[model samples]
Target: MTCSEWADENFYLSAESAYIEGRWETAPFQVAILNSMGNDEIRVVNLIKSARVGYSQMLKAATGYQLQHKKRNGMILQPTDSAASSFMKAHVETAIRDVPVLKELAPWFGKKHRDNTLEAKKFSNQRQLWCLGGTAAKNYREKSLDFIIYDELAAFPEDVEKEGAPTFLGDKRLEGSAFPKSIRGSTPKIKGHCQIERAAQESETDFLMFVPCPHCGEYQSLKWGGKDAPFGIKWAENNPRDVWYLCEHNGCVIRQHELTPHFAKAQWRCHKTGITTVDGYEFLLNGQVSETPESVTWNIWTAYSPFTTWERIARDFLNTRDDQGKLKTFVNTTLGETWDDETGEKLEWENLYARRETYLPTIPEWAVYIAGSVDTQDDRLEIKIKAYGPGEESWLIGYKRLIGDPAGELIWQKLTEYVDQSFQHASGAKMSVGLICIDSGGHYTDEVYAWCRQDPMRRIPIKGASVYGKPVANFPRKRNRKGVYLTEVGTDNAKDIIYSRLAMQAKDLTKPIKGYMHLPMVEWADELYFKGLTAERKKLSFVKGRRVYRWECPSGVRNEPTDLEVYNLAAVRIAQQHFGLDLDRARPEGRKNQSTKKRKSVHQSSWL
Candidate 1:
């Protein structure tokens, strides 16, 4: 008997299951994908599906069938250890306890029970099913498996701690098996990086679930329609309940109540030709056998789900279409597709260097406020000084490197001297550092705190926070070990802003009201500084089925310059909001004498 057939006879869905019954006919398309396991010629199956669409549950069903009927050793890899543990408790435990056959076969399935543990289950049939996290590839080395299932393939780390890619390591386990098989599934993430999407593209027979139109008898797939479409949901003015699916073939408007019956009779069809496969109409008719060694892939969405109605989807679309966070969720979860971020593009260092201005040991006339940031490294402290003007137009006036251990007192003194001094502008006015932000997340945490505590109003210690949608600078969090309140700088937001400004062309700088970054000609000429500034590129990532934007750098790339710039920009924001300091306005009378001394030092310094 096939895996889906066995699931139908003996499998029972627990309360945690989205589809409360293990009936193969209701989702015949999924059954066909699972049934492909019985084909000795086919070695791999890829299911790229929407959330709550029975992807993981299908794997569990296949596991139960293999344990009882096929009796092959297998493994399941989740994104992380915590996620693997949760999946074991939530799905694996429930399946073993609820399914009568699995209970009788895998009797010792519990904590501290010898035969079955959280990581592995030993069935009476002498077959083992191991569940592991994908982060540690070392664990995947010694195991030989007949079957393997990778859950959320796109969420796995690109490389596994010097061991190499997860997929390559998993494939190594199949080397011993005579007819090895693997199934990879994910909701997908970014286009280029999505593992499941890549696998599906490589598969010989790619399938899409299609249901016949109740009125016209034409088979069609669900699509997010634009102006031209054969199948898409349309709604009346401000009314979600009035949502209806427009059939492209016959123009028949199918209501929400009519969708469930059609879903029950859905079939798998070829994505390219729109022709139904041999198993497409098996439920409505008799099965037809075919012969091929090609691997198979299937794509399904929430439109076929009995749990999520069309009206609810329409309402969700209406509320979240305008907000990026909510819109990303809707596109990823409901639409079952990846969200492509416009800001996740790489910026060329050459393009930015071309916009540099003539070098001077001073700020320009457009400069209003002076802010500096320090990046703590084990070998040195990298400092970046930026001058800000109206609309946050900024110039990189200075970049300094103090070569010494950050943990030592010598580096701290050098950083202080650079921060305390001022630079002269072409207008002959001196500008001392209005605000300074130093990294507090390195080995020199205590040193950073000491500097910030010396003058809390101007010098602030900051730690980068990667939470999505965080403001440029969040409210100060708990005091550090040194009892100093540290600011949480939103490095993600700063990168988005910086990248947008970097994308600006040299000709576009003359445009008014645009954020312009002016680079120093000589300072940016250094190869190390240029590499550090453009070290990281923006990329899209999926976290818990939501699209997240993050900055990613290739290994061995030095991104201290990028981090320092983020800190400097975040410092200006904090100064404006928390300290009521305005860079666009003239300096206060109380600080005028300090600037005179600072200007004099600039002229006398040897480096100047």
Candidate 2:
């Protein structure tokens, strides 16, 4: 019998653990995942899922099915011992008590059987079902198993004291069996760090479900799209009441009820498994789309369980869209996707590239003053020049890389020439670098200080202070031992300012708003530059029992663009403190000369 058929006949849901308690029938979408547990060809099954999808019940059913039908020894590993104990009471033991077959297989009744205990259930056929917590290393000692179910795999401790990941240790337990099978499932959390996601990507096949459109009778992968997409879930004016799904194949208006029965006809196909496409469209899945729900096709079929509806998912998105942490939860729990902390919180590189204006080598018409930021590196110095208009409106005027060692003077001379070069404004006026901040947080700190010491007012050395709530620019009372005035930059506060502004330009915004960043359409402002700027994600974690927000740039990801932007922001603050510079009260374009002729001043005043 199929796993689903066995489950329908044997598994009984308990009142405490299930919303609707009765005979357990696996949903169509869940059938493949449960069946993979018994499929010998598939040694490992990973179900990266959303909540309220009956995953917990599948774990219980898989246990009961394997115990009776297959009679295999297994382990149900949970996050903690308490969770295992609770699962045995609320799920496993209840099944033994409510179902006659399960009771006959593993008796937990009035008989005082020592083998049938809290964590272990030894059957008459010399097979055992062990439930243990994955958090403790000792739990994995010397137990041989046929199958292992990793429940909430993401929540399991990453490592037990230093032995290794719980997954690695758990797999060792099933090494004794020839037909070893493992199942791992969880609702993913935190992009790039989701354990189930890693497992799914590494597994033999990653399956995606595709449902047929009832009206067209044409099978197409479901999509959650905006009003403009080919077809998917679309709502009017963000109203959940008006939410509906448009069929991908026929553009038919499909209500939540129309797709119910058709879900049973859904099929799981994965490109990685060599099932390439359906009807010329790439094999796609909804949850794999970008952090933005509308990036690609939406899998309304993903919400095909009897418990959830398209309107419900839409309502949840609407409720949690404004808050980052809550939105992360909604994506992880409701959408069955990983949440990128910067999804709605920061600007996408492609969108930033799309908004590029043709203004380059020349400052914009409204630009007032300029600031330069240099990010020192091992082999190069990343430079970014920005112009600010009224209200701190910023434009990325120039980007260049000095490809050499900062320890040498040749690259410094090149940078000096570039800094000394003049940029033209639209009104026949000249603009020069007003202030420059050289990052002293690299290999050549003394070189940075020496360069900045050339002109104290215009060039200054700055170091980043990651302390929370620190002011963006806090000038020290005195210079360091090197006799160079070093500025402490509050990187977190600066990121807050920059991120809040970039949030307005996430994807599409036609008009210029306050503090909107404008990029130039030039060779330097390519995809690499934009990716660097958007590389870091602001992640929230607790350290010492207090909430700490830290910017995380994955290993090998270039973050110089971000660092340069932060340095320029710090330069602005320092300029305001040391020089008579004003971003809000921008000087009018025309000079106060009675000649009535616009004359350009090649020499910028009070700038480094």
Candidate 3:
């Protein structure tokens, strides 16, 4: 019998512990996952689930079944040592004490059992069950196992003791067993980072929890509101408890009270059409897709949970709609899906390079204004020069890297010379940088200030503000200890605009009317520039029930190119607003001496 079947036959819920016991039949979705343990072909079972959905209970029941029936050694890994110990104490011990069948067959059920402890338990027939933390050290190298269970996989650190992913190491323990099984489960946390979601996407059979409609009896998965969703939870203007789920098939209203009856008829549907079974569990399919039998992955949301109510979920959604933190929790624990803090496309170096133009680092013909940005580093300084045309259209005029210590004058001199130099425009007119914004949030703060004060051009010291959802430029927040005024740049706002512009699918190097990033020739475009441009991604993180947008870069990825471009864009903005640079107006032809003529006449009138 499968683990769920075994639980139905023997496992009993303690009144002090469970609201419902021996109710495996209620969660038909979990039956296949639990039963797959006995299938030698299905080596791994992954459950990417929502919170309070009996996932933990299922794991505990599976462990108990393995100890009694298979009599095989198994290991269960939690997120941390403390969590592992708590699971052993609260759930494992209680199961041995309360379950009548476990007490009758397991040798360690009694109080005087010598082989049982908090971490490890010895069962009849020399069987053993070990409860270990995800980071419980490499001590398991010597221990062989028949089965492995990884719980709360998203919470496990990317690295354990600098060795590697904890789950990867846990699988090694089952190397000695011929028919080893690995069960992975977790409530997903972050997009692109959730282990359970990753495993599910790679699984051979991706299963979604489905329930039959009371009216038409057509099976469909419960959907949180989306473009394709026809039926969803509808509530009155002011009453959350007045919630009802709409059936897409029949357009019938399934009241909150109707969930239990419908849940009894729930089943797991295969995404692809085929007739298959994993050790007697039925999988219905419709397409002519071939099956690769190796792993079975399941996804379950709280919408189908018996312990939860539609009204309560609606109320929670209404309450958390305005707050990021609560909304993230609602998505992860309620919807059983990862939340995108900021929905945007990831930067790819190849894609950006594919749009490269033939123009060199020199200013383009459409140039109306030019700006410079510098990013300071310990060993070098990164510089980016941009030229703006009509409608805020811009091109990467030049890029330079000056190697030296920021504390020394070697790199600073190079930066000064670069900014002072003039680039010949397509009109044969010389155009120097109209504005230069050097980052002042580095060790060279005082140096940057002193240099800006001495510069004869439009150079200014600037710092990035930590505030989110603000304008790209704001009034100075506070001055440095040296009494130097610094322009505060809203990096989050700037990045949002930059990403939006980068997302534009341009056919050529010509800039778009509204917002577009123009790239230069192949000489100026390289792999490193593209890497920095697409290095960081916008991620949504929750704090105190509020959503906080974070610009995160993976470890070992350099984001200096992105930083330099942001500051450069900020400089162009300052020039447009404060310096009266008309980015939308084209520079007039044969107007090189217009300003000079006015100045000469004014000088003659003053002499009179």
Please provide, for model 2 over 443-514, each residue's C-alpha lDDT reduced to its tens digit, 9 standing for 90 to 100: 899889888888776787888885677888887777788877799898888888887776564343333356
Q: How does each model score on lDDT?
A: 0.74, 0.74, 0.73
Tell me the tens digit of each residue's lDDT in model 3 across 344-445: 667678888887777664565666677889988878888888877766667888889898888888778888898878787665566777778889888877
Candidate 3 lowest-lDDT run of ten: 599-608
Q: What lDDT does model 2 reach?
A: 0.74
| Root-mean-square deviation of every model | 15.0, 16.7, 11.5
Model 3: CA > 4 A from native: 20-26, 110-114, 226-230, 272-280, 284-292, 342-362, 365-393, 396-424, 427-497, 500-608
The parts of candidate 1 lying over 4 Å away from their true place are 16-26, 226-231, 272-290, 343-345, 351-608
RMSD of 3: 11.5
* Clash pairs detected, candidate 2: 222-298, 223-298, 224-298, 458-608
- Deviation (Å) of 297 in candidate 2: 19
Give the least accurate 10-residue stretch of model 1, judged by summed lDDT.
599-608
Candidate 3, residue 368: the lDDT equals 66
lDDT of 1 by residue, 435-548 (tens): 788888988787888878887766778887857667888747455667676888878888888878767665534333336777878944576777778988765554532345
